[model samples]
Target: MTTSHETSLPTCELGPGGPIVSRLALGTMTFGVETDESVARRQLDEFVEAGGTFVDTADVYGDGASEEIIGRWAAARGGVDDLIVATKGRFAPPAGSHGASRRSIHRSVDRSLRRLGLDAIDVYFVHGWDDFTPIEETLDALTSLVRAGKIHHIAWSNVTGWQLQRIITTATLGDFVPPVAVQPQYNLIDRGIELEVLPCCLEAGLGIAPWSPLGGGWLTGKYDRGQRPTGNTRLGDDPERGVEAYDVRNTERTWRILDEVMSIADEHSRSPGHVAIAWLLSRPGVASVLLGARTAEQLNDNLAAADLVLSDAELGRLTSVSATHLPPYPYGMIEDFCDVDVWKRLGTASSA
Candidate 1:
C-alpha cells in the first residue's frame, strides 16, 4: 500500500511484483544508538511527511533497538500499513547456532516481527552470506516464512557475484522462493560491485538497494584531505569503524572523486552528498538509495537529493572520475573476445 499522502519523491517497483517504493529509503541503523527515541520518532515522522514509504533496518543494529523504535513509532501513528518495511537477519543468530541456519532464521523472523509490531514483514533480507550453512538451508527457511505469511519477499545482502548467482540458482533448482532484490555497498567511491555483483543483478532481474551510498560520509565533503578527523562525525568518533575508514579511503583517487563531486554540487547549488546520490540513482539497477542519517536534519538534507538531477555530461564526468578497475583474468579477456562490454556499459571500466 502507498502512503496516505502523496510523496514528493518519485517511486518505482523494487523488482518484478515487488513493492513500489520511494527512490530514497529511510535507514534506521542509528535509531537507538546516536539518535534517541524522541529524535528517531521525529526522523520517522519527517520521512513519512516527505513521502518516504520504505524503511530499512537490521536486527543487529543497536541489538534490535532500531526495530523496536520503529515499532513504537508505527504504533503511535496507528500502523505502517501504508509503508514498505524491510529488515535483515543472519547477523545475530540464536545461542550456539550459526547465522542463516533454519533454526536461526526462524527465530530471527519471529523476533523481528515482534519488535517491528507487524504481522508480516514487507521484505526480509539475509544480512550476509553464511559460510557455515548451506544456501539451500537458508532458502528453505525463507520459503517457509513466505508460505506462513511471515515475509512478503526475500533478498540477500553483502554477497559476491558468484554467491548471489548461486543463491538464485539454488532457489530455482530447489523450487524455493527466489529473491527479488540484492543489497550491496555501492557508491561513486566503491563500484567494485560493477565487476560482477551488479551484472548478475541486471541479468537475473533483481533490483538493487545500495547501502552506504554516501560511502559512509566520505562523499559528504565533510572530511579534509591529509588531516585526521576530529569532530562528532562518524569517522570523528571512530575512523576505522567500517568500510569507509579514513586511512583506507584517504588516497589520491578518493580526493579526486570528492573534488569532482564538489564541483558538480557547486554547479547545481546542492550539497556534495546530493550530487553523489543523484549519480547513484542514474545507475542501471538501483531501485532505491538508503540514507543512513542519525538525525531528522540530516535525513531532510539527504532526501533533497531526490530532486537534484544531473545532466548526462555531469553524470559522465562523475562516473569517469570514480570508475573502478576491472580485473584481468576472465572479466577483461571475456570482454575482449565476445564483443561483450560489461563494466564499460556501467562507465566503470578503468585501466585493467
Candidate 2:
C-alpha cells in the first residue's frame, strides 16, 4: 500500500539495519513530559503508519520518561527491527551528574538501554559538549561502546563547529568511528548554526537533525503578541523561562515575519507549523527535521511537511524576513560577496 512518493524519497543511513530513513524524524521530547503515555503511544503509532521510521529521544528528557515511553511503544508496535532508534546521553540528570566521562557515559548508556529495552541503540548522541572533559576521552569511550556492540553509531548534539572538527580530527588520528549525525537547535528563528555548524556538517558528510524546528512552538502562531500562553504545556510548566523564550515583546520583528508566513500558509491551506517545518526540509544538508509534537494531530500535520514544496518566491519571502543578521567582519564580508552565481549553478541559491 506504499505510495510512489513514500517509496522514492531518499533516506539517510544511521547504521546496520538500513540506509536513509524518511526525511522527517519524530522527536520524543514531549512524549513523556507534556503528553501522557496513551497519547504518546498513539502518536508513535501514527508516525510509523506514515512510514516514519526515525525516532529521536534523549535520556535527560523528562528524566528518562521519553525513552521509557518510546521503549514501551516499540515493544507494543511489533516492528522493532525496522525502526531506527536514536537516543542521546551526556546531559546531567536533575541531580547534577553530567559529563562525557567514561564512568558517566557507561552508566548513562546502560540506563538508557534499560529504559529503551533495546540491546544496542541505533544512533547514540553526546547530548552536549563537555568543556571540562577531553574530546579524545569522550570519543574513545564512544568508540569502545561501538566495539562492545552496545551502540551501532555515534552522533552529537548542541556542539560547536570547532568541537565537532576537533573530534573528527582526533577520531581520524585514533582510527575511531566518527559521528554520523549532529542534532542541533535549528529553525527559522535560530539560524545561529548557519554561521558555521551547517558548513562543517556538510563538509564532514554528517547528517544534521534540527531540533526545535518550531522555535519552541514560537512559529506555531499559537502565542499572541501581547498575551502570554496560559495553558500551553511548556509555558505553563516554566513560566519564567517560557516568558523569556516565547515573549512576543522581544520578538516583535519575528512575529511580524510570522504574520507573513501565516498568510502564505493560509493561502496554501496549510498550518503555519507545517510551513515552518517545510522550510527546514527545503534547506541544504538537512537530512531530517526533528518535530516534537504533543498530540497525534500535531504529528500528522508535521508529517505533511515532507509533501509540501514551497515555491521560489515563497522561500525568498521567508528568507528575507527571517534571515539572522550575523556580526560584521569576515562573516559579513562573505555574506555580502559570497558568489550568488556559484550557488545558482549548484541550485542552492534558493536555499541560501
Best by TM-score: 1
- Across 17-82, the per-residue lDDT of candidate 1 in tens digits comes to 788899899998998999999999999999999989899999999999999999999999999999
Global lDDT of model 1: 0.92
Write down the lDDT that model 2 would get.
Answer: 0.78
Q: Model 2 — which ten-residue stretch has the worst lDDT? A: 342-351
Model 1 alpha-carbon drift over 4 Å, by segment: 1-5
Error of 2 at 252 (Å): 2.8
TM-score for candidate 1, please give it.
Answer: 0.97
lDDT values, one for every candidate: 0.92, 0.78
RMSD of 1: 1.8
lDDT digits (tens) for residues 1-352 of candidate 2: 1123453333555422223666888899887778899999998888888888788998988999999988888788664788788899887532444489777888899999999999999899999889777888888889999999999888899888898898878988988888888888888777778767877776777888888888877788877776767785565455456323555334667787789779889989998988898888877677778878889998888888778889988987787677765556565556468853423322223332
